[model samples]
Target: MADAEALTPRVFIARHGETEWAKNGRHTGKTDIELTPYGIKQVHTSAKELVGAKKLLDPARLAHVFVSPRIRAQQTFHLLFEGANSVPDESVTVTEDIAEWDYGDYEGLKTAEIHALRKSRGLDAERPWSIWKDGSEGGESPEQIAERLDRLIAQIRDIQRPAMKGEKAADVVVVAHGHILRVFAKRWLNCPVDLPVDMVLPPGGIGILSYKNNNVNEPAIQIGIALPVTD
Candidate 1:
């Protein structure tokens, strides 16, 4: 068994790099879109800076990776792991559970456009539209998203708990979209979905979640942004 301190497990959430719609603030859910040339470059840079020896996420410690099925997410995952050593192809799983929120009727629309549409439809005139509260119509509700995320969080804990006992390396990486990954971070801390998330996840950004006190009961999201490494 490895030392318990050395075996503390972590979940690293990496948001995919920019797409045309993402750059323009459009709601990109369930849409398969490729990363822009700049987005590809951004993720490659992120891979070099954040993943490796003595970096934010050591590749050797990574046990598994979950990625969204979206093309942008897949592309970002590919670029992010390009330089990683000994990461097996089977260890990476593309799962819909981590995919972006199904924007439904709001899909492809920017925030301002969605707001205007809601106003024209006489909905939520008194309060600004919040995906956290109301969710996207013809799509998932907050409760639905919460249920799935809660399940995934539990599964992550199950995978990490044994590692905390020093059985093996248990760091897991999730590559996905902005809103979903942000929500995952919030839920990792057991925060309510109705609460506003002040954390900002830029394109190709990486956020860390791990146990405090080396116990599964003390889950917390690490503060401070992780910047890309320059070569």
Candidate 2:
């Protein structure tokens, strides 16, 4: 039997860097946007701290990479893996399943703005609107998002399981937007989709999901950030 440490596969999720809409608290979905100058710098720094030899994500250990179709996400992925000499271009796949949540009518609107609009429409008068619960009009619901993420998760495990038993690396990386990745994290841990998640992944932040005790049945989110060590 493989040791507990050897067979555990990991998923690394990196949220795309800041955009104009993201900076202003707008719901950025479907619409393509480029990373701001600061956003580019942020991801470059994250790449330095998180990827490479002896880093949280060693390039040699990366088995596959799933990137969102959004430009911001695609740009972030390139920046993060720019220096990863071991990861080949062919190993990456652009998947819509990992794309940002479709904000639909809520696109370009802030939370407060959406709430005001909802109030005007006599929707959720007693409580603020929650995308996890109420979903966006003409957009995907919590159930839909959950279903998509679940399917992706299963695919990830299928790729990793066999590799875990061999000498090849089994780590998978995903570059996506905030809400979808947060919801993905929740679903990764088998938590209820509608439950409020206090967890936050700032722009260019990285989160890790791995199995506990090398058992796929016991998945967990490894909390904490990887920061550069300074003397």
Candidate 3:
């Protein structure tokens, strides 16, 4: 019999390149930001990384490439795909489920400003990300985002499970914003989904996540498909 270990799927994730707000420490939810010149180059490099990883991936087994609808994510995938060795029937797909966290009342505000306001209310001003439950005065609650993210992952898994079952379809790639992607990771692994989803996207930092024969809830499930940014 063939190795039982051969029957698992892999998932690749790519974070979009640099933006004006990304350069400075600012909240970038729902903001349509463009990639910088450096970001363009980084996406190219990341695409090559994706191609290199194809050595382990079966073309027939690769289900599909999923991406957030945001322009930055779209641009990132378009450019990276230019370097991919193989062509897929359907390339980039967008999911509203993967959009960035809604900051609501504090959309474009800086952390410091938000902190001041929260401090006036005697809340823990240092825990900006911890407010997922309460949400911003007018933003989305963590439970809300987590619920949607969970359903989205379920949607994706349903689509891929057929291929995964056959032994050829085993993996997919995704391009999306930082927080949403990270939060999606939390939800994908059946975690609490309470994390700030703190991830740093350098130009076009590329990472990989997997659901093969492992516990998703474990803290160490985030293994590397490509070298993660060390900063």
lDDT per residue, candidate 1, 61-127, as tens digits?
8889998989999888888887444379878878888999999999999999999999999999688
In model 2, where do residues sit more than 4 Å from their true spots?
1-3, 84-86, 163-167, 225-231
- Sort the predicted structures by lDDT, highest score first: 2, 1, 3
Compared with the true structure, what per-residue lDDT tens digits does model 3 show for residues 10-58? 5666788887787775777787888888888788776654454435433
Error of 2 at 99 (Å): 0.6
Q: After superposition, how far is residue 57 of candidate 3 from its true place, in Å?
A: 6.6
Worst 10 residues of 2 by lDDT: 222-231
Per-model CA lDDT versus the true structure: 0.84, 0.86, 0.66
Residue 7 error, candidate 3, Å: 4.8
What lDDT, from 0 to 1, does candidate 1 have? Answer: 0.84
Q: CA lDDT of 115 in candidate 1? A: 94
* TM-score for all models, in order of appearance: 0.91, 0.92, 0.79
Q: lDDT per residue, candidate 2, 58-117, as tens digits?
A: 788788999999999999988988744447878898988899999988999999999988
Which scores better on lDDT, 1 or 3?
A: 1
- Clashes counted in candidate 3 amount to 4
CA-RMSD of model 1? 3.4
What's the C-alpha lDDT at position 149 in model 1?
86
Q: TM-score for candidate 1, please give it.
A: 0.91
